[model samples]
Target: MYAGTAKFPVRKGKNYLLRIVNAAVYNHLFFMVASHNLTVVAVDTSYTKPYITDILVLSSGQIADVLLTANQAKAKYYMAAKVYTTHSEANIDNTTTTAILSYVGSKSSTTPILPEYNDTATVTNFREASDVAILQAYHFHIDDVYTTDFPSNPPIEYNYNGDVDKTLWVPISGTRVKVNEYNATVQVVFEGTNIFQADKPSNAYSRL
Candidate 1:
């Protein structure tokens, strides 16, 4: 959702491919359209096995391409977006940003009701994804073993089938960068998503 306003017009009986990006500074996003179902076709730059879902779960740096059909009777519907806050104990954003999915000739005041702030089931169903599309970020496949005492797993045993609770969520003990060695194979997967990096020279992180 845009900061100031969110509204876009579309013609009826047309299929629209939405290039949705979760560019949140530090939060995942759950996006949906009122009275419409999204056919998710792609993610990032790769095409996914087409699946239909009312809600889309996106990481901060992830991108999804969904096909939307304006099949509903010509009327203004609400396109809602809210932060997916199951990663933590409590929600930080109370405002669910909304936009109007206006049919070129219809008007209405009804808005789409979004999911709860801490809806984990939807997020889990989306996360257990199966990748399609013969595309990868890198061409070369160099498998190397990680060498260090750095924690490679989450600090807790996370069960996606549970409700939102602070005690259920994993807690990061602290940032643990690997030790710098002269000649060692590095196999690390960095999740720098949902974070904003400034142009300052300092190596400080806004979020750990």
Candidate 2:
């Protein structure tokens, strides 16, 4: 329940490199700074082509390196991390972990507009494997937020309608994980899906 921490000072026109690590035990974070945009420089120990984005989402064990330039007006801003929910259960942390980004010689502080704690629909969609970022990356890129090199696509567009295929809709109780080698090149779909299976479509439906 540590809602906020000490103030971090900055000066106008200076740039800072930050290592943002998500080491939480059971939470994911959506981090942002009030009135500031982050230029993402790296992820999980690998240097990525710099990408600029406003809100960043990171799961436990993930690390993001971002460049922050103090180019805004000389004032104080809130840099905050709030929980991003997983599972479609009725649970969440409505509190935020915040720290002040105070510009030297500034007098006022403005809190950032934090994102909603957990939009179950979006989270469920992400879990459902239908998010645009995830679906689009099925061909040559990433899952959501992380970038990956290419692997051939499913070779054909396959459909899975859970409404008709009850047996194929969910994973059995015990979760079996597949391990990959270090730096292995493979694409994994964790929603119990294998769209490449050429069996009856009724046996191909999967859901999270």
Candidate 3:
């Protein structure tokens, strides 16, 4: 709900860093500005090349930064942040909303207004803006750094028949436990395996 003009003055043409964070418990946020395109500069504390985009998709506990440039004259543009999810029982009645991004020293002092929540065109535009081109470009750069100089010998060796013989079997299970501190029932699940020796060599081969 922190919507308004930035405290600092925004200069036109110059790239400004926009640090975005999603604090919602379950919803993923898509941020966009009306008519303007954003250049994603970084994500998850990693720097990336500037790539043009409109929307930034952010899940809870994720952070991203984009370079916003004022290509046009001073004017108000709707800064919107919408939540998207695939949960069937999701409650979206109170999700999508817009904020104002006012340019400094512009002739128009009026704040930018966003389209209605149900506006189809607005939704489409946001979806189109969520491209990951910049991220892909960054990944390409990383790949170039690690020249493919694989070792001649393979890392692991396997034998069809080995002398050492110990075949184990493991089972997984879960149970509920009572906690006096919380005064509630807690479910505990054991991960991995419950080991047991194989009855026969053929049984071990069959399990494998």
Candidate 4:
């Protein structure tokens, strides 16, 4: 399944900058242009060393500027984004969204190949969740909005990367807040829980 279609008309042998943003609230997406290698130039509004890649792994709210050279055959190609998940049992929408990259005077379009949902070996690297509403509750001291009982340690320890028990797959939800001293240096270490819904909150404001 897919959403709206957007078309981009380009001239052959010319370069174009594609600013891609992953705005999904809780989806880690893999984006690509058919038969094209995109050179990533900037990430999160900061310029970076040029890195050419065939596929980009975008977490929620990530912004990437890539340079695309229209040097392939003069035909339209599909630019697509699809969901990527690490956990095998995680329930997610296995669908793709697409746009068109059409060459000047080209009429035919080719379907782009997207990565599989559980293509863990292909994704070596890694959204938004209810953080904003939780923050508002904290600022207003609204105790009912969220609870402070978020666990600091695992309730039951088990093999993290190996086969996990189904009981530990879903955890109790709460808005846990930590109060820090003024001007204190803080270091946050995010642990991967191997659950897609549980991991999204930690990676909400990530860069590509």
The count of residue-pair clashes in candidate 2 stands at 0
Q: Write the per-residue lDDT of candidate 1 for residues 77-164, one digit (tens) a residue.
A: 8887888785554438757877788899785645777777788887787765433222221233212222235655655543333333
Pairwise lDDT winner, candidates 2 and 4: 4
Instruction: Compose the digit string of candidate 2's lDDT tens values, residues 9-102.
Output: 9999999998999888888887889999888767887765466766777788788899999999999898888888755436765578888888
1-208 per-residue lDDT for model 4 (tens digits):
2236788899999999999999999988899999999987778988654667788888799888999999999888999999988766357888788889989998777887887887876676421111225667678775554566655565677765546678877765444655555666655545677654334223233222
Q: Compose the digit string of candidate 3's lDDT tens values, residues 1-208.
A: 3345343456677777888788888766667776677777667778654457666667787778887887767866667776665544344744556655666775453333344434556556544444335345356553322223333342343232343223322212222122233444433322222223222223211111
Candidate 1, residue 174: lDDT? 29
Clash statistics: count for each candidate: 0, 0, 0, 0
Top-lDDT structure, candidate number: 4
Best by TM-score: 1
User: Looking at candidate 2, what is the lDDT of residue 36?
Assistant: 92
Error of 4 at 205 (Å): 36
Against the true structure, candidate 4 has what lDDT? 0.75
Q: Indicate the residue-level lDDT of 86 in model 3.
A: 51
Q: What is the TM-score of each predicted model, taking all chains together?
A: 0.58, 0.56, 0.48, 0.57
* C-alpha lDDT score of every prediction, in listed order: 0.68, 0.67, 0.54, 0.75
